[model samples]
Target: MLPAMIDIGVNLTDKRFADDREAVIERAREAGVSRLILTGTSLECSERALALCERFEGQLYFTAGVHPHHASEFGADSQRALESLAAHPACVAIGETGLDFCRNFSTPAEQTAAFERQLELACSTGLPLFLHEREAHSRQLDMLRACRDDFERAVAHCFTGTREELYGYLDLDLHIGITGWICDERRGAHLLPLLRDIPPGRLLLETDAPYLTPRDLRPKPKSGRNEPAYLPHIARRVASETGETEAALRARVLANSEAFFGL
Candidate 1:
């Protein structure tokens, strides 16, 4: 049997899973994905994720914050709501928050503002950060560095950047989350070499579900919606690159997830 694993990031609250979230979790359970941290990108999403966590009990936990795309809507009310949610037992982290300069769904300035506030919340709540960064590593790193000493912990969720970006996060003593992105030959090939760069305790695993389904999954799920069950596939790819057996990789990744998230 495969080693038990933890999917440290999952969008279980996404409407895509509305009809079959329980079935999705059951598949993950059968695949040996022992636990999940649902990603919350907004107040509505965060509330839903928390409700799902309560429904699923010990199997689920969630992060609470606003994503950069919705950064424009962030303000006093958002911060207050997130602060309230962060107090919940099921709320395990303080984000889905960070900068995303790729599309600028929210402008750089707005994204930065929202990210900074979420950083404050993380410190205040004593919860680790669940971060997102796409083409804004330098700015996000700068902001993180500024308050690195204040926050307890953080993870670069769904890291798909370059070696330099990976090094930047490692330098901050931050945990790194790998997803099915590494299973894709086109965009994720560069990540293969960087896998070994992430030392043991700092590496985490995730699916970023409803997104980033491993490109090569045979007979892909008919819905084409990613979920926690495929984490073992991502682990297999990581093991191949790192020259560790999938069993060993899963054990180490599970340890890292437990340590980072207190799972």
Candidate 2:
């Protein structure tokens, strides 16, 4: 069986856990999740993520960078600030950064600029890129291609694209992070074929918790909040869909996480 889970993406700075963050983490450990990588989406959130890392000690690690949605706020000094946070031993990667055309929270030009800047920083620090791309896969891929020489490690986190997009990412040698979104019947069915094609070594599992709760939940949390505690269900579903034993799937996912994040 898979050893346990390492949630590669989560937004703990979200207020959804204001009252019971400790309990949430306790639940994750109960579910066999050994580590949680809190995503740093903005400067403020990065700081909060760092604080949470400190609070949880070795159980929780964090990234230090900004999200594309906040790209408009990215200034010349943003890289320096991110570098300071990323220097912390608990900081595992640099981002949640990329292009998000769906939200339009930032202009396309601004997002592109910010994406490149963070990619450069990640290259400089030798940290993996925790990427987010939505409704802009073509442009995102183009940007990645431009930085192909610079970026050595990256994951397309919370991937929700088509099979072609999946192939494109894999062809570029980037890792794939799967979220509980795959458990949804309506929108996620299209991803089954993609799931079938992913090699054991290239896949990573994540909750993107406080967000995409898996469909098989029992005694569901009242607030509809997804937590790392629910990660095992994600693995189970992937096993069922991919025709692999759950134990084998779990072991592969654990290995993938270790290699991808250097955990």
Candidate 3:
């Protein structure tokens, strides 16, 4: 039997998959991606992800929290709703949360306030955090340092940063979620060297589907849409960087992902 794999991140609710989301999950199954955790970028998206998990039940799960991009819209009601969502059996983590200063889609102040609030949610719910950080790692690290002991655990999702940032996250005992970004010959080259530094059981894999498609993917999807189905393609590349066989990588990540998200 093919080794089972878990995709720790997937944006299955993105409009790109609107027409055929079920088929996408089926494709992931055929690819040996036996499980997936759909990301919740906003209150609405979190609800949508949870609904999808219900449909897929045993094979799928979701995280509940706001993405930094929507920090401005995150209000008191948003926190209340997320608290409710986080209580669901299908909700495995407390984010799609963290800081994103690269675009400043939301002001730094808004992002910081929202992030700290979600940190409390993770603390209260006793759920791990699915965190995102871009260009604002210094400040994010400062905040996490201040509150790290409160939350159980967190994964630095879609990490594609400097060695300092990688080590900083590692210092805090954060799991690293590597994605297809490591496949990009230009921007992802740096991540290849950092792979071996991730301690065993601290490395997780994600597709971040419909977002960071492995830039070198063969016969790339006609729609240019990434999905869980292509995860194994990414595994082969990650394995090369870490000096492990693909099966070994898959088995290691399966155990790590489950424990990280309480799956």
Candidate 3 lDDT, 1-263, residue by residue in tens: 65899999999999999999989999999999989999999999999999988888999999998999999999879889999999999999988999998999999999999999999999988999999998999999999999888999999999999999999999999999999999999899988989999999899999999988888998888888899989999999989888999999888888898898888
Worst 10 residues of 1 by lDDT: 254-263
Q: How accurate is candidate 1 locally (lDDT)?
A: 0.91
Candidate 3: segments with Cα more than 4 A from true spot:
none
TM-score for predicted model 2 compared with the true structure: 0.97
Query: What TM-score quantifies how close candidate 3 is to the native fold?
Result: 0.98
The worst-scoring run of ten residues by lDDT in candidate 2 lies at 214-223
lDDT of 3: 0.92
lDDT of 2 at 72: 98
Candidate 1, superposed: residue stretches over 4 Å from native: none
**RMSD in Å for all candidates:** 1.0, 1.2, 0.8
lDDT per residue for candidate 1 within 122-157, as digits (tens), equals 988789999999988888999999999999999999
Instruction: Give the per-residue lDDT digits (tens) of candidate 2, residues 1-263.
Output: 34888988888788998898898889889889989999999999999999999999989999888888999999989988998998999999999899999988999999998998899988888899999998999999988888878877999999888889999899889999998889888888888778988877899999998998877577777888899988888888889989988888988988888888888
Q: lDDT for each of the candidates?
A: 0.91, 0.89, 0.92
Highest lDDT model number: 3
Q: Any residue pairs clashing in model 2, and if so which?
A: 1-247, 2-250, 2-251
**TM-score of candidate 1 on Cα atoms, chains taken together:** 0.98
